[model samples]
Target: MSKPLGKILSEGKTKKVRETENSDVALLEFKDSITVLDGEKMDVLRGKAVINAHISAYFLEILEKKGVPTHYIEFVEPNMMKVKNLEMLPVEIVCRNIAAGHLVKNYPIKEGTLLNPPVVEFYLKDDARHDPMLNEDHFLILGLASRGEVKKIKEITLKTNRILSDALKAKGLTLVDFKIEVGRGTDGKIYVGDEINGDSMRIWEVGTDKILDKDVYRKGGTMEQVLNTYIQLYQKLLGKMPPIRGTKNE
Candidate 1:
């Protein structure tokens, strides 16, 4: 097995870290714990780490097969992956395949509006300000990204969404909405960062408007149960067994 290189630099809610061989790289440990309601509550959901790793690994594998540029290298275990430590852009790329939630609430669109060409929105990643929406000009004015970089990010984001959405649909899951974060590596190559989980997606029941994904949490579902449902749905879609992990509290 390839040994890790450096010391862990930072950690996030979904992933932990250890150093990798590369100075600008690390091993990301995707924990079984989950947070929701904007990190207001958390739970150590049983088997979550394993399920998350499997889901992400499977998705990234598909993306790579479909020729998307990402930071995935190799899986270390049920809970870990080898990846580059990237300098993240303080923005979130939101891609909507079908309209619901805030989109329906904020716009005059119907609930199940299907966007022919996926709509992409950018948001400032400032939690304190609730991640306010921004435009391409905001990126230039804030000096957060060059015009060229912004264009590149947009192009890649759209391509990523298109490919992933099609792939998921083939597996009977509608890729309603999802978020992406981009970052720069030591060589200045832009790659995707962060875990793409149920929290980052807005999946819905294929035939009904019944919601799945993070909307469950928003709709008052318990953290543990909601995340488990997500894992189960993902596993069903991928036609895989749910890897068993931590024991559930009786």
Candidate 2:
């Protein structure tokens, strides 16, 4: 099940990629495996890949309808997505609506503090360096992105945060913070790329800090609890249970 040379692309903790039947498209095969703390903590959660693929597709479609450009093409399988092949930008755009994670650990911010206007941060996408935080000047110094490009990335990220936060609020969940990657397509336009699932976001039950996202896996939560929370979220947003991989129907 391996793709030919030049057809196979990059691999990450939870995803693999190969060329699709369409030359301009690629298939992202999500895996059941999960990684946390910079891949130091890892495990296999049955059915997770399927759930994430479906959830990512759901959000991408909604964002597309809202005039946000993304690389998403379609869900080709329960655990695979067909997307436009992109020259990914080497940065991770993060928008935080609440003080948590590194925000609290690195800064003096108190946990649960509401960021009235969500804070946007950028990190150079270098795993070996643990993805060091970057500023606009850093982007210029490293030749990673132009100031204009950085500005646009921030704008799009903030808009996405609003859209996702509102969507989750309607489902009785809160979007604590999320990270997104962007890329340039063959069309010569920058679009949001990569998947947006529980792994990329921190979600909590409305009005309470009941973790419902990957933070569970990071914090030693059980796989059963993690999968159940993901299922509940999908059911709330999509009005149906996601088909689990390895099942007859899936």
Candidate 3:
């Protein structure tokens, strides 16, 4: 169903908006759009809408099964889901299982190294500000969350990372890293909100160096191929027939 104009709420890179029947809930229409390098106006990957919808639905279902709090209700369409509206926290939680990118650039660390306990990093959610990294002390200093809340966030985030990593590994994809955002409800309980699609994760091929994330688009790779890979992975997880592979744009 198209979003009723009176109920339209917020819209992001790959999703549209509409208020749901619940006053505090909204309907999210995931678009077939792809962005890279943190929305730096990168090329839009074709077939992204279908791929991301499948991926997000699968992960949300997984979180529901694991007893974690989330905002998702049910998929209303091939590219839409209903969820609770939340006062989104102004931080992006990134948990890295392998050393890569900024970690190597900012610290004296070797690339492809393993983080025994994994590394949980936070950044301000301000897109214009370039999402600066933050520590626990920084989180507290900014009053973004209380000490107890921060602890709870860490616990949930790490748990999510571990579970998704193992899950992707089972499908021949290594979860090198991923980003998450949490929001608090009126009762002060944190629910995993926002989209949890393939766009928010770094999925790598197990044996080879094939990357299935938006990185493929950032590097000017085959957008259609990359998006199809993500959709294929999601289809595999959901026990559904995958979409026919489309010809790559080269």
Candidate 4:
């Protein structure tokens, strides 16, 4: 018989999740690094990892309180989170509220157009193929997820959009769009997985198209500017500033 696997479940572009031997909980370690354009662009912005870790934990906790299932357990350290170990699905779910980014480039819609009844998209979570778009049929054919699972994912994702959109509105920000990952838990239930931070979403200041998310960094903004913007957004959302690490407060 084959031996049981050891620790270190998986690693991504900016984070790694590890499971202790004989434990069902995993520790997610966020790195002080950023990647854009499928990681063709990269840099390390001090304090970013900690800020994102806190922000993601805050959002996940809020969602959980709202009855949304998630893998998030608790924030363990400045750049680490303790979470439920999950068998992650190979798909990325995206919910868009405003026409921006690839929506404008791929469609005839103008930038900033309100997508009434927000758009939900599914993409195969393969970095090598740049996460190609997939439809329901595609998913079924590829065995990525069952029809029931897809339905459940969409339901949870839309509910999440409503909750986050309203929450951000109260903070004078617009939830332009966001991406989330999902996974199956030991209980055989799917839950929202991965980090939900600035990097996963496009946030803009209310009433204006002032970018306040990773888009700023992707568009050639300075590291200081990116960090400051993230701090400002986090403060606005949580009503307090996150502690900085390895960087001076701006």
Specify the highest-TM-score model's number. Answer: 4
Looking at model 2, which ten-residue stretch has the lowest summed lDDT? 241-250
- Between candidates 1 and 3, name the one with more favorable lDDT: 3
Runs in model 3 with CA error above 4 Å? Answer: 1-6, 239-250
Q: State the lDDT of candidate 1 residue by residue for 136-223, as single tens digits.
A: 8899899889888888888988888887777767866688988989999888977877767676887766676556576776777876
* Per-prediction TM-score to the true structure, in the order listed: 0.88, 0.93, 0.88, 0.93
Candidate 2 is scored at a TM of 0.93
Give one clash count per candidate, in the order shown.
5, 0, 1, 0
Candidate topping lDDT = 4
RMSD (CA, angstroms), candidate 2: 2.6
The CA lDDT of each predicted structure is 0.76, 0.87, 0.77, 0.89
- Write the residue-wise lDDT of candidate 3 on 166-238 in tens digits: 7787878788888889999877888888778667877778888577676666666675567666755665566
Residue clash pairs of candidate 1: 5-20, 5-21, 6-19, 6-20, 32-49
Answer with 3 or 4, whichever has the higher TM-score. 4
Superposed by TM-score, candidate 3 places the C-alpha of residue 85 at a distance from the truth, in angstroms, of 1.8
